[model samples]
Target: MATLLVLGFSSGLPFYLTSKTLQAWMTTAKVDLATIGFFSLVTLPYSLKFVWAPLMDRYTPPFLGRRRGWVLITQVLLLLVIAAMSLHDPRTGLKMLAVNAIAIAFFSASQDISLDAYRTDVLETREMGAGAAVFVMGYRIAMITTGALAFFLADRTSWNNVYLLIALLMIIGIAATFVAAEPVLNDAPPKSLAEAVVLPFADFFQRAGVLRALVVLLFIVAYKYSDSLAGSMTTPFLLQAGFSQSEVGAVFLGVGVIATIAGVVVAGAAIGKIGINRSLWIFVVFQGLSNLTYYGLSLSGKNHGFMVSAVITENFGLGLVTGAMTAYLMSMCNKRFTATQFALLSSLMAASRDILVAPAGKIIEGVGWPGFFLITVAMAIPPLILLPFIAPWSSDVPIGAAPHTGETIPARRPQPPLAVRR
Candidate 1:
């Protein structure tokens, strides 16, 4: 779990550095909103990450194990791009920064593919839920430190120092990868690359309904819509609320961070006590309700305390909601196609946020805060409506039965002898 936590940062740090944190960098640089908005497009690689997931599945990196190789490779590239990103001015080198952002997102997405695969493979069946919980706790911390602290640091120090700190911090992942043991596979390895590449696609398509896949995609996209769309406007909103920068950091990044960790911890415990189904429904509804915090803050005339209260509540709900959600998604993937299907589901899930949420600035500009938030609440509806349909569709487990979620389930052959390298 400690190793997973470190690796989680490798996956999560690039996310903030490229998205919200980058926006903060640009706004300071006097870049225009339209141009800054264009930077969001750099996240395209995140939504389209499934494109290269197959390559990761087919080819192992020469140095690290298959999973760790991709992670190491991406980590190296990430440090380079973030460092390069630090060197350029978004105003004069906006185009160059855009290029760097894409590179980071690409590397970040690849890192996700390998790390998630390892997390899934390493833990036992029933333990998967717990693993997801721990991993997300780590991911959320990375978001806070990278997303919130990076902004806080950039405010006080040079963006150069902030980026440099984050780059070197990635060494945690490198070291973790080296020390960590490889995971046991539940299924037989493909004898050839074609079987490796071809099976996942066939497995995905051969499942029950065409509309089901499409709807699953819709759920993936919509479930996160409210959160992501509302997020784009948070900094501006906090500024408008008359809070000082320190207050914003201390509130959302500080207390909000603590609350989020608490929520994740509680959520994991809840998932263990209650089954994933009950946990899912409860958390999903809680997720939609959490958005009301923003509405409350907005309607309360942006009171600083109100903003703090709202952030804490929303993040807590998110920690609870997301921990269970990932476990559910894990239960839904076929072990045979774990990398590809998961990448597909996860990328689709991110698309809901990155693609759907990009319009937040426009919406807030057009509709005002109250209206924009209400629209965000409306965006939450599709996923809740869609979850029931998806909750029943198991790519890994059958419809009526719960997943083989508990136990190691006894492997026929113990995980391929670590002594032999393919």
Candidate 2:
């Protein structure tokens, strides 16, 4: 659990550095809204990481076994690339900054593939809910460091200095990598690159069938769409609304962190009692409705009270939804193909954040903040409609179900080993 937390933090740090923190830097550099929106494209690697996930699965590095080896490699690259970013100024070197951001995203996405596979491999079936919560807590804490702490530091020091400090923090992840135990899987690693790539998809489709698999993928995409759309422009929105970087950081560090942690804790506890599907239904409604706080902030202007309320509500909801979603995704993976399958599922989730929300700048310009937030709220509805089909409210266990649950029955019978099938 401790290892998972540290790994989660490592996974989250580069993420905000490239997206949210970079947006903050660009906003302060006086970049226009449209460019900032389009800049999200740099994170395209995150949305397409599944393309190379098989490579990680097919071959193990010489040290630290399969998962940890990749984790260490990606962390080292992230450290160097993020430090490289510190040398470039967003105002004068916008294009160069974009390139650095993409590199960071690529390494970050790769690290996530390894980390997710590691976590999936290590945990017992019963541990999934608590593990997701702990991982998310670590993930959100790292976001606070990059999001809130970075904002505060940037207000005092140079953005370059802020980036450098964040780069140095990668050492923590590297240290955790050394300490983590390599998971001993019952199944062997994929025998070939072809087996790694083709079999994960084949296994998924075979398990869920074509129609249900399509619905599940759509649910993954839609579940977090509203939050992603709204979050894409939040930093710029807050700055444009007359809040200083420190003030924004203060709120995030204070109520935002507290509320988010609370949500994760509550959702984590609730999932065990009510089950993941019910937790998703309950948490997602709040996730969507939380956008209204931002709508209210847009109307109220720079009022700190509204700002505090907005931050608390939105982050709390984000925490709840993120916890539930993490467990759901983890539940869907087969042990042998965890790296590829989880990467594919999470990449689709990232699409909503990066690709689908890329039009947010144009949309915000046309609709205004209030109208734009309304659209985000509406975006949350499609997934709710999908729940009945993909995850029925009455069902507690996930589709494939994690192995070794004595009480819960898997929706489908376990298949023979890949070797046997081949």
- Winning candidate number (lDDT): 2
Residues 1-422, model 2: lDDT tens digits: 78778888998898788788999899998999999999989988877889999998899999888778899999999999999987897778888888999999999989988999888777665566677888888888898889878988998998999999999999999999888877766678789999999999888888778898998999999999989999889889999999999898778778988898888888878888888888889889999999999998999899988899899999899889888888888888887788999988988887787789999999999999999999989988999998887678998856655462222222233686776554
Clashing pairs in 1: 125-405, 126-405, 126-406
Q: Which parts of model 1 have CA positions greater than 4 angstroms off?
A: 19-40, 62-64, 80-101, 147-162, 189-198, 205-214, 226-249, 295-302, 357-384, 392-422
Off by over 4 Å in 2: 19-42, 82-102, 147-165, 232-253, 292-303, 358-378, 402-422
**How many backbone clashes does every candidate have?**
3, 0
lDDT for 243 in candidate 2 is 98
**Decoy 2 TM-score against native:** 0.79
Candidate number of the best TM-score? 2
Task: Go through the candidates in order and give the C-alpha RMSD of each one to the true structure.
Answer: 5.3, 7.2
| Collision pairs in model 2 | none
